[model samples]
Target chain A: MAEDLVLDTAIRDWVLVPLSVVMVLIGVLRYFVSKLLRSSQTPDAKVVREGQLILRARNLRAAGGFIPVKSFRARRFYYTNEENGLLHVPKGQAQNPQAQMFSDPNMAMDMMKKNLSMIIPQSLTFAWVNFFFSGFVAAKLPFPLTPRFRSMLQNGIDLSTVDVSYVSGRSWYFLNLFGLRGLFSLILGEENAMDDTQRMMQMGGGFGVDPTKNLGAEKDGIDIIQHEWTLPKMEQRAEMVLRKLVK
Target chain B: MVGATEEARLNQLESQVDNGGGGAWEYLCLVRKLKARRSEKVLRHGIFILNSHIARSKLGGEEWTLYEQVAVAAMDCHRNDIANDCIEALSKKFPGSIRVGRLKGMLLEAKGAWPDAEKIYAQLLVDNPLDQIILKRKVAIAKAQGNLAAAVEYLNNYLETFMADHDAWRELAELYISIQMYKQAAFCYEELILSQPTVPLYHLAYADVLYTMGGLENLQAAKKYYASTINLTGGKNTRALYGICLSSVAINQLTKGRNKDEKDSADLQPLAAEALLKDYKERAPEKLPLVTAMLRNIKLVS
Candidate 1:
């Protein structure tokens, strides 16, 4: 039954409104920046072929039951045959973790550019919020929260006596950081770079997953499939149905 | 032609926005929807919306997509200048964009600059070997140049890498059929049928190809596929029903005088004939007598 803090109208203008507006503007700016910085380099042929190979292999594994045994065997042999198979990654091929990033300077450079775009704007916004708004408590939330939220919703503040619902300036900035995703998506289209959540996922996706490993996995997948020529079964089924219709 | 009701709905949308009401965004959205549905003859409305300065400014982000769309429609309608303007704008905006480059290549193709278009596509392929658009354009270029064999080669090469692309398989199948390579066409259809066993379209096409092949084994396979098509479509596919009856009769003729094979399709003839007769009776009662007469001539119902 503790009393709620009556937030000043000035806090609304200087803190809350400005924080929201700046977040939006920053999102828009970041989108345009990333769009400009996006490398228009045509994808390499080997990488393209590898992706297509995976897709083809996946399709074979999923739908190979339908094709004739001869065709399926031929495909399996083409992909999984020990010596000259396409999916075969020679074990002698020593994989260096950084080798891909180093060999393809363009790819590494593109990622660097992406990271810079995301990181620079993000840090700048953090710093801007910290500098201007510092320890100023921005607003009070209407709803109650557990004491566990106190540290999260009250980032830059020292006194822990305040309710967990009271959002501090820095925490409000952090809140706006993640919370404005919907607003950003609304203002900018779904594919916009304004989505940090997607960027984080992409970052975690972590480049150069050693294409050899992917190929080997697909190779194993294709190796296990038992070919059941679907047309033969269909013929029998059709014959059975036709026979039954007469009966 | 599109249905009159669809045309009327479009007309209302077009006039309401184009004449007085200021719903440029809504009109643009409708146009985009039409584009998604692949509805042809949106050229006039699209060009009008694109040309209007009011709508132009209001269409944030979607403006470029609209430009690309209208440019394509303009190219299809043979309005080269409009396409040129749209391409110029896109190229200016996204200087080295592959999509814009494609538009440029397509523009060259539209203008009948065969070699130039081919050169652009070749360069695009070189730059991005994985670029399916460029590869597809290469096939298109070969087709446009009246080198169907080359087109087939290019498409085959494309499919060799991208084997899972059903659309590519379908296109290749059609190309094979067009060149009268029924065997190759049948192979493509077989692949299609195998990949998508549930699709009646693939079954029907495979049946057609097998029927065209016309051996005892092929005819039997064709009859089974036709039956599959009928079953998949819940017996509503008239072509499939007809195909079933036709293939069944052909199958019966082939197996005549031979001791009936244990798993023979002799009984399918009557079932398929009955279905076709029932379908014709329900769908087109006027044609039911003619169908009955035809069935009688074929000796299915006698």
Candidate 2:
């Protein structure tokens, strides 16, 4: 009876102890890794926002920013709102008035080219990793069910994870995220930081959802809730309507 | 925000860590949660591309450095295979990147050795069954091996997992037709037609299946669809099987003794002959060599 008790304890220990150790190790490692990877230079949320806008402007310039509109239909006015840094048009508009600031097709083409270069690979890598990692997690899960059941459960996650989660979970998201980021950086060119957190909020369907619900939509949270915080003016909306028709 | 599944998984993993006695199940579940988190991260990045500066950048430039990093990381971690799987998953978002890989895969698939490739693909499928490229590869390999049985099996499995994929159903139906599994083919076509009622090609395929199966009760439906198929194809251009439709219609008319009366009647106009010709062309394209072969068989019988 004593031996049996000892054996049961040993078996239970064998399963639990190593798992606990791995979990702690993983948690600590992830915490440190994120801290290390995140930018310390642009620490504040406001600073990050400013930096992002500036980078976007630079990208717009490099890509040749243009809003295809006739002068009579659309007028551009520059704004000096330091929060937004530099605006190409007056701030109080029904729509994004700055869109008209881009009248040069070459600039538009360049901007579009720049945007595509930035977006295509980044989006692809993100999607690829998303599916892959999700699949991996599902594939590697511990279940008391059949292999078919396990597979069905895993498929409920995504595709990319199947191979990725099998080998290592740490490197799973890391590699995919890095690859996507790098591809975007190379394609978009120079200094423009893509804010993944914001993108995620949008993707999660939380972007357009009523702001009062999500913490991110709070006044002090972030200015990404552009429609709610700073409503678009009338003239801008008219131009936007015309642009939609042409499209 | 994490979903209930991920939260539950995280809690389970956390409990394992806290209790310090959790087993392999805990580790595996934790790994799954972590992977899920990572996927959410990737999706987040994709959203960023859509709404931010990434969407406004040029093609094949430094702006896409993040994607390069992802590729490098995928390679570094030996997830090149996973990266390859990403080709189809990300196609809707990153057509440029995924299409390049897809075309490469297509080029490679053209060479024989698909059976060997099938083993590799099976491993990938075990990991991510929803992977379209890998699934497509497996289907092709199965077909090439003349293992129509296996192809049908995998196709059914794939369809079950991806219920909305009309392409898989279409392929399964086509494979059944090729193997002369008329009843199953007809059933598949019938199901596909129900799902996508407007696509005329589905209707034509269903009729072909019914006709091949010799389901006399199904003939009215078959004829209706066949006529619809002709209308959909503009009555002039037949798919690959124009001759078969023409011959069948002609045989039907002759069997009914209408052809004899029509030929004998002086009232029969040029328009009537044109209609007959149109039916022939619709049944089997004149360009196909099979039409001549079919004619030879008929002549011998006569």
Most accurate candidate by lDDT: 1
lDDT of 2 by residue, B1-302 (tens): 36678778776755664465534233433444354433333333333442355342632343243343333234334455544444434444565453344333443344455655565565554544456667776777778778889989888876644544656778888888888888778756655654555456776677666555553334433444554454444443244134234334444544564434224322111222233344456665663355445444444111
State the TM-score for model 2: 0.33
Write model 2 residue lDDT over A1-247, tens digit each, in one string. Answer: 1111112454234433443344334333433444454432213333333343343333222221111122101111111233432332223532321343265455355444433444554566446544544422311323344435434344344443233222232233443343344444454443343434434454455223431222212212222212111111212332233233223
> What does candidate 1 score on TM?
0.80
Top TM-score: which candidate number? 1
Candidate 1 wrong stretches, greater than 4 Å: A1-22, A94-97, A124-138, A147-151, A154-163, A168-170, A229-247, B1-40, B50-68, B79-108, B111-113, B123-130, B194-197, B214-217, B253-267, B285-290
Which residue pairs clash in candidate 1?
Answer: none
Could you tell me how far off, in angstroms, the CA of residue B106 lies in candidate 2 after the best superposition? 7.7
lDDT of 1 by residue, B1-302 (tens): 24567667767777886676756556656666654343244556667777888867777767898888878877888888989998898888889888998998999999999899988887876667778878898899889888999999999999877776788899899999989999889778767765676778888898898899899877766776777776676666778768877876776677774635524545556777787777677779999899999999988887
User: What would the per-residue lDDT of candidate 1 be over residues A72-105, giving only the tens digit for each residue?
Assistant: 7877898899998989988968365478678978
Using DockQ as the measure, the top candidate is 1
When candidate 1 is compared with the true two-chain complex, its DockQ is 0.33
lDDT against the true structure, per candidate, is 0.78, 0.43
Q: Each predicted model: what fraction of the native A–B Cα contacts (within 8 Å) does it retain?
A: 0.36, 0.00
